[model samples]
Target: MTDTVLVTYGTTNGSTAQIAEAVADILRKDGLTVESRPARSVTGVAPYGAVVVGGALYAGRWHKDARRFVRRHRVELAERPVWFFSSGPLDASAAERDIPPVRGVQRTMVRLDVREHVTFGGRLEEGAKGRMAGMILRSGKGGDFRDFGAIEAWAHRIAEALAHT
Candidate 1:
């Protein structure tokens, strides 16, 4: 039998969406039916056998829509299997990974008891398409540093969990 998997995410520069698609591809390869969509497009979680939610982080936070989806479907999510991922914290350039104060969607996910969560490095375009992100980028912070290997490994873990349960 095939499983219905919903992979949803919120992205600023679209890196998170790329990550989500990669995850969905992994699941699809496992013989499951996967649908990838933006978090804002999701109306309900009732139709999915499993839910994978992810979003890019801005200023130490997950996107609002991703968090809101979990909040709106908390009851259903709790009853089913849900996995979460965040795209944030560009390369440390050193050994230290210091996460700032908890804020936004991440905080909301914690309250909802999501089964698993992962964080991947995000990228920022140095140009001036948007001022807020550009400011952060210009601050000498960093750029896209997502580890595709780690992402695939995490997706496989979720697949295993769903397979056994």
Candidate 2:
């Protein structure tokens, strides 16, 4: 496989997309060719040597697009290195500890023999889409809780792992 990596994500208010871009940036800096794209827009995974798929959480489940991306590309992904991340939890919990992957993500990881998985803090702010987002904002729970330092560190780990492979 070539040293090309695909970083893709499913996002609601665009926060998860930002996280994916950050990961792609780090991978690129590590001298890997990287491509960042929305999960819904990717048609195939065959061209990538490695893949990082991230999803935004909503009510304890992954975004529809991320779930669909995994399901559709399961075959191709199994043949290469794959990592998964979830961005949700508008709190500092993710930064403070190792947030375990939800059931669906866990199952996918096991089935695909995924390299690793992580749960990063999420972001919710004004102008977010969806009724639940508006409700959360009204309840004063909306905020940016993503920790870029942790995200970059994780990407560095991925880059290191890629180097050995």
Candidate 3:
């Protein structure tokens, strides 16, 4: 029987949501069942064999909803395979650094025995809806920095790991 994986994320400007959807598509293409949803909307992880939790990173922290989701579903997540991803760091150099998860996220990562945590380059569009986000985007470092090929490669790795598990 095929196992279902849940790819849930919290996105500020929708870039992270796109990444989550890309992940779900890759998993599905690899013959696994997948569900992609926003972090705040996911009520439970009980139905999934594996879970991928992601969020937009701002000021070196994950979005609040993603952090809360992990905290609220700590026990259930601990009982299954869980992976975490942070989509941010518009600066290319920043993406190369091994950025650590925020304090609250760190605690939950420990509790859940998170399989992996990836930091991907993010997109920042000028004049976006968010106030601070717009200010940042206007700083002359905004463009589509997302590396789709890298994202797909990572998703393939996840698919391989899930297949073995």
- Using TM-score as the measure, the top candidate is 2
RMSD of 3: 1.7
Evaluate model 2: give its TM-score: 0.98
Poorly placed runs, candidate 3 (over 4 Å): 94-98
Please tell me which predicted candidate would have the highest lDDT against the true structure. Answer: 2
lDDT of predicted model 1: 0.77
CA error at residue 34 for candidate 1, angstroms: 0.8
Better model by TM-score: candidate 1 vs candidate 3: 3
Total clashes for model 1: 1
> Using Cα atoms with residue i matched to residue i, what is each candidate's TM-score against the true structure?
0.85, 0.98, 0.92
Question: For candidate 3, lDDT tens digit of each residue in 38-130?
Answer: 999999999999999999988878988898888788889999899988888787743456667766667778877998887888888865668
Q: Candidate 1's residue-wise lDDT over 1-165, tens digit each?
A: 326989999886788899999999998887788999999999988889889999777666678877677777888887677888888676752114534324555565666667877677777766625677777777977576877887788888888888887
User: Which lDDT values do the candidates have, in the order given?
Assistant: 0.77, 0.94, 0.85
Q: Between candidates 1 and 3, which one is better according to lDDT?
A: 3
Error of 3 at 159 (Å): 0.6
lDDT of 2 by residue, 1-165 (tens): 247899999998999999999999998888889999999999999889999999999999999999999999999999999999999998889999998999999999999999999999999999999999999999999899999999999999999999988
